[model samples]
Target: MSRVILVFYGSYRQDRQGIKLARWIVEALAARGDRAELVDAKAVDLPMLDRRHSDYREGEAPAAMAALADRIAAADGFVFVAGEYNGGLQPGLKNLVDHYLPQFAWRPAAVASYSAGPFAGIRAATAWRTTLGAMGMVVTSTPLSLARIGGAFDTAGLPAGEDGGRLIKAFPRFADDLCWWIDAAKAQRAAERPPF
Candidate 1:
């Protein structure tokens, strides 16, 4: 079955490169017949998590947080596009993850990390793998890492030349692995009906 995937990016700058990559990935997934939507961290406008469980018990969460949680809960899988900051995951993305907990359970996630430098944001992807895994997400092992991302795309925001070819080649395996896990997880969730 076709999957509904959320391609979420963590970049809050006025001129963000991660957005471009996020759009590209979303389009690619769509072309492959997946229903993919791009979710910008800035657009979500989630505040830092400061409320206690008692606060949550009192009433509904903030509108933005509730909407984000709804989208995440509805998605069959995820593609988290992370940009490196100081050789680590961006704080905005970390905050987004921290704000919602149960939305990610029993879901599969694939990470695509990018950097303006030569390192390809591998460290950020590594950190995300650990964090998402701990949150009960089945994170795919084959992550897409883009190095010198500033030049990796063309004016149309599509990957260019070698980078484009490489990503196109690798995407099938990544998507396959992610979809496999998503399907398996969904089946298990249906059969076991474990509370997430």
Candidate 2:
């Protein structure tokens, strides 16, 4: 069955490389016949979290965030694209994720992280796994990490040379695992009461 997957990228600057990578992943998913949608955190333009308990209890999310909440709620799975900054995820991405808690419950999440350095944003992926788990998401274990991102992709945003070869080979497995989780999670959600 076709799955609705949200490809969420955490980048606010126009020159950011993560955005390009996010687009590539979305295209790849679409090519595989999945219904993929891109959610650029910068475009969402959510403010920092500073809401009162009454506001949260009343479901009074900021106007800009309401639509995002709806999209996240509708998605069967998620792909989180992030870049490492100060050994963690970008603040904008973190803030956007913090805006909604229940929407992520019991969903599956996969992480793809890129960096200019040799580590390939592994630290950021690790951080995402932790945070996503805490939010009640079943994060995939096989995360996609691209190091020296400047040299990783060509003009078409496809991986180049050896990097391309490796990613091309690995992507199918990753996608398969993620889709399995999505199907299993959706079935579980349908059969049982929500944990939240």
Candidate 3:
């Protein structure tokens, strides 16, 4: 069965490069028979963290926040396309995620971090592990770290050259790992209730 996966990209920059990677991820997931959607943080345009969805009355929350809460709860898995900034998580993504917690609980999440420099945003991806865990997602072990992301993915969201070739080869392992965990989580959730 095709899983409902959300590929989240959070970048507020004027000329965003990480979005290319996010688009590639969504296409790749779709090619693999997953119903993937790119949840662009810039497009969502949520305000800074304040009252979460659960904190608001049934219909009082912002339209975007309320709609995203429903989508998050329905998704079987999530993938974060993170961009490094000062060796830390992107503020846009951090803010978007902070808007809700329970909506993410019990799902599996994977991180694919990238940057224009050589570090590939590994630092930010590593930092996200604790945050993701705290938000109640089972983090995937396989990670996609892309360095000099502009060279790896073209503007059309396709892998470009040699670096792209290597990334394409590595993607299967990363995707399969997430799928495995998603299957396990789906089976478990169907079998019994989560003890919370």
In terms of lDDT, the best-performing candidate is 3
Question: What overall lDDT goes with each candidate model?
Answer: 0.84, 0.85, 0.92
Ten-residue segment with the worst summed lDDT in candidate 2? 52-61
lDDT of 3 by residue, 1-196 (tens): 8999999999999989998899999999999999999999999999999888889999999999999999999999999999999989999999999999999999999999998988889999999988999999999999888889878876667898876887798899999999999999999899987846
Q: Cα RMSD for candidate 2? A: 2.0
TM-scores, each model vs. reference: 0.93, 0.92, 0.97
- Can you list the residue pairs that collide in candidate 1? none
Q: Kindly give the stretch of ten consecutive residues in candidate 1 with the minimal lDDT sum.
A: 51-60
Superposed model 1: Cα runs more than 4 Å off: 52-55, 193-196
How many clashes would you count in candidate 1?
0
On TM-score, the candidate that comes out on top is: 3
Give residue 113's lDDT in candidate 2 (0 to 100): 88
Q: Cα RMSD to native, each candidate?
A: 2.0, 2.0, 1.0
Q: Is candidate 1 or candidate 3 better by lDDT?
A: 3
lDDT for model 3, please.
0.92
Comparing 1 with 3 on TM-score, the higher-scoring candidate is: 3
